[model samples]
Structure formats: C-alpha cells, structure tokens
Target: MELSCKVNYALLALLELARHRERGKLVQIEQIAADYQIPDRYLAQLLMTLRRCGIVRSQRGAKGGYLLAREPGQITLLEVFTCLEGTWSHKQESQAASLTQAHFAIEEIWQEATMAATAVLQRYTLEDLRQKRDEGQQFNPMYYI
Candidate 1:
C-alpha cells in the first residue's frame, strides 16, 4: 500500500494545476517542478503519461504549457492512480488454482482491503484535494517570546 514517488509527483503537479484551473491559464512543467521541487525531466515524463491517459493536456508554442483535460471536480483520485499505476488485479489465475482453504481466506480478506482502498480513492477528486490544501494553508502558527 506504499505510494509510489511517481504517483506523488503526479498528484503534486496536478494539485498545482488544480490551483490554477480557475484562472484558465496554462502552467508550464518547469514552474510546477520549481514549485514542488520535482525534477524537471521526471515531471515532464509524468505529464506526458497523464496527457496520454486523458488526465492532462499540453499546448505547444512560446506560451506552451499544460493544463488538466477536465475540471478538477471531474477527475477522481482513483482515475489518476490507475493512470499511473495501471489497473488493480488480484492474484494470477495460476496462483489461485494452487490455493488451499487458508490461502483462500487470506485472499478474501486482501480483496476486501483492496476494495476499501479503491472506494476511498474513488470518493475524492482533485478539487477536494485542492480544498483541503487551501484549508491547511489558512492556519498560521504564532511564536511569542
């Protein structure tokens, strides 16, 4: 259940785009990389993957940059995750055929966990994440000597 660095960088890039989505302005990959400290080359590759998956779009020219393909509210975390990680599948058919009762029980529990995780991912969208980030930014700690 560990999150991959690729997915994390993708999400951070997406979040930056989600923030600028309301402005209707394209954000360049270098800007996103600088903002989040992601490597420029790696971010470019991730954006390309996202573009191919229909999660983001790119524009070419002097003003060329990237933007989300759909509204932030319309893009679910599950969709982003699947785009980067590929679709989730259970144990292979060959492995399943060799399982005993104990193994079957363990597999059932694993399936349940996977389903739960999927449900959570599907429930939230990029807009939701943006809102959460905004909320966190509103808090400032006071230091008194």
Candidate 2:
C-alpha cells in the first residue's frame, strides 16, 4: 500500500507527538514541520484535518499548539489512515466480471488481500510506531560534541 505525502507527514507529526505525550506537551505545527522538513502550511492543513476528525485537539492563543485527543496506545493506524484516506474502494475494477468459478476465485483473492491489509493496520497503534522508531534510533549515535 502506497502512502501519500500527506499521510506520511501526518504519521511523522503524530509520532513526534507520541514521543512527547508523556509530558502532556502541546507541540506546535512549526516545530513538527521543521523537524520533518515539511511545509508548515501543508502540515497545518493536515493537522486541522486530524483535529476535525477527533484524533487531535488544538489550543488557541499564546503557548498554543496541538495535542493528541487520546492516548497514543488507544489510536490505531487504521483509524488514522481511514481518517486521512477515507474508505477503501476497488477503483481498479473496471466492470462486473462473469459469474464463473475463475471469477469467484479472483474475487476471493482480492477479498482476502483487503482483509489481510486491514488486519495488519488494525494491529498497531501510534505508541507501537513510536517504540519501534525509538528502538531503531538507538543504534544511530548523535553527533553532538
């Protein structure tokens, strides 16, 4: 499954928020954009979408920013992907196929593929991603003096 740049940016921003979740800190869009080298305006729009979808909450005025609306462990990747990508549809299907055994077999394969993808997506949460990311980062030493 290919992910759009917007979805990737959203995931990066959420992972950053998940990293800071323990502190109950509100992370500003500019910080997220700068950290990931994404456009601030675009990230803002994505964050707004997430906010509208109830995955995130926004604070106004000075010291304002965004925060996850729920625990990172409570938010599944499926929920985030669906909120960003909407429902899945077989747009590649051109027309209805003839009701033959071969056609049914092909349909069953597609159905199983979709179900397997959904099952994998639903198996993880933002916290899981954060943990994996942290684990991977541990081996890469920082270059600060």
Candidate 3:
C-alpha cells in the first residue's frame, strides 16, 4: 500500500513535535515545514486538522505555535492515520450484496490483509518512531575528508 503525501507529511510534522515534547516548548509551523521541506501552507492545514482531533494543541500569540496534546507514547500511528486518512477499511459496502463466492474469498483475504496492517500501525507510537530515528542517527557511518 502506498502512503499518501499528506499522511506522510502529517507524520513527519508530528515527529518534529514529538522530538521537542520533553522541552515543553511549542514548535512553530515554519520550523517544522523548513526542517522537513514541507510546504508551509500545507503543513499549517495539517496541523489545524491535528489540533481539531486533539492530537496537537495550538496557541495564539506573539510566541504562539503548536505542541502535542498528549505525550508521544500515548499517540499511536494508527490514531494519526485515522485522524488524517479516516478509517482504513477498503471494502466496497455497496458491492457486498453482489459478490460471488470467488469474490467473497478475495475479499476475505483483503480483510485479513487490512487487519494485519492495522495491527502493525496500532503497535507503533510516535515514541517508538523517535527511538528508531535516534538509533539510525547513532548508527550512521561518517566519512571524513
């Protein structure tokens, strides 16, 4: 399955927030956008959506910005996915009544696949991602001139 650019950007934006969550400082949209090369307008829109869903909170002032509403460990990737992408079911509800046995079998397999993917997503929280990213950074090989 392909990850949409919108969802990818949302996750990256969240990761940025997660990284700074411990400092209790709000991260501005421009900083996140510039760091990840995401468009400012698009990231703003995504952040608003996240805020509405209680995944992140926004402040309005001279030093205003955004911060996670909950800790990174409390937010699952599946939660973010559902917030941005909606429910993950791929079944065609309208076609359910017309399916033949062969179609039913194929659909059953599809459902299993979807469930597996959902489980994987649910198992990972933003904290898990942050740790993985930190580990990768630590293991990267350096080439000195």
Candidate 4:
C-alpha cells in the first residue's frame, strides 16, 4: 500500500513527541521539526490533526507549544496510525495486471501482514519505546570519559 507523505511525516513527528512524553510538558514544534528534520509548517498541520483526534494538546503564546493529551503508557502506535493514517478497512478492486485468482491471493497476504503488524505495534507503549531507545544508547560503543 502507498502511504502518503502526511502519514510518514506524522509518524516521525509522533516519535519525537513520544520521546519527550516523560517530561509531561509542552514541547515546541520548532524543536520537534529540528530533531526529525521535518518542515515546521507541515508538522504544525499534523499536530493539529492529532490534537483534533485528542492524541495531543497545544498551548499558545510564549512558553506555549504542544504535549501529549494522554500519558505515554496510555498511547499506542495503533492509535497513532489510526489517528494519522486512518484504518485499512476497504478492499481494493483487482487491477488489469493481475488475474482474478491473484487478486484474492494478494489480498490475503496483505490482510495477514496488516494484522501481524498491528499486533506487534499495539504491544508496545510510548514509555516502553523510550526505555528501549535509552537502553540502546547506553550500550553504544563510546566509552564514558
């Protein structure tokens, strides 16, 4: 399936937010975009969508930015995908390149892959993700001074 630029950007943006979930404080869009190399304006749009979905909350004016609407442990990648990517509930029609038999066969593979992926993603919470990232950095080759 073809994922849209918005979906990719939103996922990257969400990962950034997830990393900062422990702070439980508003984080600026500029900071998030800079860390992920994403465009600030584009991220603002995605955050707005997430905000609407009640996944994130934003503050205005000085000392204003954004924060997760819920705790990190309560957030799941599935929810992120659902809010940003939408659910994959529709089955596509057969293309001319494939025969009728191939169409249903391809659909089965697609369904299995989607279900397995969803199951794996739903198993980890944002806090678990943060701990994993922290662990990797701790085991890096660089020795402490």
TM-score of each: 0.91, 0.87, 0.92, 0.79
Candidate 1 to truth, TM: 0.91
Q: Model 3, 16-60: lDDT tens per residue? A: 999888999999999999999999999999999999999999999
Runs off by more than 4 Å, candidate 3: 93-98, 143-145
Native-referenced Cα lDDT, model 2: 0.87
Regions of candidate 2 where Cα sits further than 4 Å from its true position? 92-104, 141-145
Clashing pairs in 1: none
Off by over 4 Å in 1: 92-97, 143-145
Ranking by TM-score: 3, 1, 2, 4
Tens-digit lDDT track for model 2 on 1-145? 6888878999999998887779999999999999999999999999999999999999997899999999999999988989999856654344556366776687788788888888888999999998899899888977987
Candidate 4: C-alpha RMSD after superposition: 3.7
Clashing residue pairs, backbone N/CA/C < 3 A, model 2: none
lDDT head-to-head 2 vs 4, winner:
2
Candidate 1 lDDT by residue in tens digits, 1-145: 8789999999999999988888989999999999899999999999999999999999999899999999999999999999999967777455656878887787799889899999999999999999998899898778999
